[model samples]
Target: MTPDQATPLLDRVNLPSDLKGFSDTELRQIADELRHETISTVAETGGHLGAGLGVVELTVALHAVFNTPRDRLIWDVSHQCYPHKILTGRRPRAKTLRKGGGLSGFTKRSESPYDPFGAAHSSTSISAALGFAVARDLGASPEHGLGDVIAVIGDGAISAGMAYEGLNNAGHLKKRMIVILNDNEMSIAPPTGAMSSYLSRLYAGAPFQEFKAAAKGAVSLLPEPFQEGARRAKELVKSVTVGGTLFEELGFSYIGPIDGHDMEQLLNVLRTVKARADGPVLIHAITRKGKGYAPAEQAKDKGHATAKFDPATGEQKKAPSNAPSYTRVFADYLIREAEADPLITAVTAAMPSGTGLNLFAERFPDRTFDVGIAEQHGVTFCAGMAAGGLKPFCALYSTFLQRGYDQVVHDVAIQRLPVRFAIDRAGLVGADGPTHAGSFDIAFLANLPDFVVMAAADEAELAHMVATAASIDDRPSAFRFPRGEGVGVEMPERGTPLEIGKGRIVREGSRVAILSFGARLSECLRAAENLAARGITPTIADARFAKPLDQNLIRDLATNHEALITIEEGAVGGFGSHVAQFLSDEGLLDTGLKFRSMVFPDTFIDHDSPASMYAAAAMNAPDIEAKVLKVLDIASLAAERRA
Candidate 1:
């Protein structure tokens, strides 16, 4: 930061306490060095690059002004916490980010005292921070000495329903907390909804150079009911600070549209709030997503996420692709379906690119809707579309779909609307770990009445499932696919709809049958080859449908094979449990047929390669091979004893 100086300011700082010793100018220098360090760190270990870069000065200001760990600072989604993590004594391990047994990409309470609350999902920070504020007053942990509670939420995150709930509750309670609205005008995608438009209007006029003028300008934007109260609050602030009309209407001491990049402004504003704030405060800071880094700033997503890249050139280093990803395959197939049906439409909750719906949006802009991080609303909106006789595919990550479970059950499943759920990232997603891993969707969705749940075993099967879901007109249907590339299998030009509740046998064998669901079909095939080495030839079948499962096929497998094994890339109460329940009901297990269900263990697996994660869960190829042998060996031992 100080070019001529021999020593860098960041080298002296190991923790937030070290920042307290520095002068304002030195703190600014530290912020600059911190930004540089962040860029360098993420270059080595790619992660959420833009957010941390955007909040470098703010991260410094928060840590310098607030007594974090003692004073809780919760980051909404915590993707922006990279700079915060570096300052909080985690700089040494920064390179280990998002790896197995390494630092998490998001905040974790277990990781550090500074990270008082953990978050990977969005919009929960305000509520969590508010809870901390209330707990601080209640003296919940007297030993920790909680001082202040601050929540830094993005413009996109603040648009969600839960944030509004937190705002409403906080407004009523009027606690001494702070909510810093980081108005970057970009999230993983561009910010949407009325709130985004409102924020854009707040800073677009360039009237915010003077605080009083900004206050006067910001007030006129409020609704009639809110405007009078906003004017009173603006009058109350008396030229020292500005009133944010919407936040003020919610009874927060709205503060700024200040330059988040400005070290002086951030420090002054934060320090002023810390010294004198009595009620809830909202500081509006307008910043860029990829503030300092040129490559990130120029990129479409503002470099929200990336692979390891060159620090100098910002060119990413990626392995050569052997096949198209499941996401891309789904998007391509969905486009084909859309071409055939005029009523076919798509929806995603702020993750167009992630769900591969960005491609669909490009093809049919009118048919694709992005509901902006509000999964609950998105689900119901799709249901409404379905009710209006339009075929709507609600494409959401398996993890994100959990947020809309209640709506899915009520609006879609109860009414039996023909809403197609295209579930992406439906297994142990690597890097992002358990928080984002889609483990419960199969169990949760399959449990509902008349709900058709399918898991694609490969890219081609995924294409077929998309067509199958589109054809199912009377009831709701969902199909899940994993992250990453398909197994380089030959793909069909277009999808031919498969029969509901039926499965197909890939190979014929005797003594044992391995019935696989989802992407684990490939692993079953791999295990079969290994089993063949020992003269234990096992049959392999792909169970396409989880819910209305092919009972005839299950009965046949039980009747023929000495042992049957069910495997899926999901939690315990999913496909395996359903199959087991059916077998027990039919008295198939009563006839002494040995059976095993290989699934993810009861615990949450940490961030790792999917291979490592499955290995830990004992659901890999070797695990499958081991389970078959264990079941057959037990039968062999029983026979030996009988002899």
Candidate 2:
């Protein structure tokens, strides 16, 4: 939206510098308007809503108090950065969030000077903030300049180990930095009574040197041994309370449990810290996710993500689906499997709903685990369960599974544990873009020795694969599937297990062949129809297992067909690459066979519609047809005929 069309305060405020002229009361108004603007923008664009809404006041207060672009204000995870983006000259493109060629849903360094550190995944902001502070103290010269560094991390994000690592280091360095814990999970009314607030205010009210010792004794969260030393010093501030001793133990001067929504309190706390802090300080500002909007506040997940919705009623305008989503299919099948097998259990790293494990959890709550934002722990935990003779399904997004790669290698793969990895979002996901794409799992998992890697051709195939993985009790196995609904294929009442390392022929043909390893089988079949209309019938096969190579099926295709093409919805080093290696090692390449590998292009595709992204990667149906024609040495002739 144009600055002219927005509310009075936002219209005048194009940048954080513009916030300087606004009074505290006016700043509160700007925050309120910014919240409305955020809701309206996300209602149209369908990006993260709740996190941004929660931080509307905090966003305004930070900018209004600090000299941003110079101060290096960082947001943890940055899903809450929409309001920050609006105050930093990105309001015009706010409605285009997560769209192709538009603003990112999270903070991006390339997008604006205010976004000094880019983040999508959680728990890295504290470290980045400290780096900036160290740089400023060392007199590093840059165009954006440098001042006091602040990392606004949420309570959920602060739970990760990496955040504590940054905190431990920062406390040791004693740098002049701020790490505001956006404590949305807490109540707005702090348990620490009015008396504690008065003491903190007094600490902030006094000059630095005069009250430094007294302030540290009173409000500084010291270790128990150190607290005894301050016993006499702390006696004046009797019955005063403060939270966050863990942070203080890590070396930070912890403050607050403050009401984050109160503009006066926020401004006062922020301004005091900006002037007074000489060491790492963690300000716990208690706010609520989906704070202002009633619909959002009441909804589960606090309306974290939404489709295009009616702003008044908060009703999503999603297109009706004829088929159950891939996630849903997996969940239902897993529940059925768990019904028969008492040993079957599931685990997901903070993505219960996204992976559809929430449904499974509802069926068997005791058998389900939601390890919060910790993929490494989730993977190892599954490995342990398997070791204890339990059938553990480590369900995780293909992108998030990357976080636990080392654990997979050491704890699972090397140990040869029977961990069934239900990998979801195994292709180009729409809206979330490259950061969330499941483009690498097949390549990484298939390359591991003694690992059984499979990809479902469709929802029915996904069902079968789930059963197959369950039966493989001696070794680790994984099956990948894409996002969104299946291709309206009829679901099986119960899945039947397929033989290990075997593939199935989808259609018989002549001259050339298209062997698919994943969800792209549908595209391959569509391309074959186009080829058949043109009097060329290509053999199509679903190479269910990426590893184990389906040697007999592969050899037969290479010997029978003049051309053999392998395609998958993965990056270059996955199924297709493995096939090429096998064909070469088996002396099949020496027989003048025209071999081609069709995979995602070697680049990070930006956010777009899934169809558009597939087209950009040249893996859509027409691209498949073109690959077939070119491999058959008829592409130029086909082009000439069309011309």
Give one digit per residue, the lDDT tens place, for model 2 in 1-643: 2322358888899999999998999999999899889988988899888889998999999999999888899999898999999999999988889998899888888889989998888889999999988988887856656588999987666656678789999999999899998877611111122323433443353344223343343243443454565556446544443244456788887665567898998897788778777788888776789899888898867878889887888899999999999999999999999999999999987678888988998899999887766688889999999999999999989998998999999999999999999999999998888888999999999999999999999999999998998899999999999999999998899999999999989999999989999999999999889889889999999999998789999999999999999999899899988999999999999999999998888998888989999999988888888888888889684564334
Give the least accurate 10-residue stretch of model 2, judged by summed lDDT: 186-195
Model 1 Cα lDDT, one tens digit per residue, 1-643: 2223333789888889888999999998898788888888888888899999999999999999998778889999999999999999999999999888899999998899999899999999999988999998898989888599999999999999999999989988999999999989988999789889888877665754554424443443333565677577567666552336678788887777788998998887788788777888888888999888899999999999989988787899999988899999999999999999989999999999999999999999999999998999999999999999999999999999999999999999999999999999999998898899999999999999999999999999999999999999999999999999998989999999999999999989899999999999998999889778778789999999998999999999999999999999889999989999999999999998998888889998999888898888888877787788778885563343233
Model 2 TM-score is 0.91
Top candidate by lDDT: 1
Clashing pairs in 1: none
lDDT of each: 0.89, 0.85
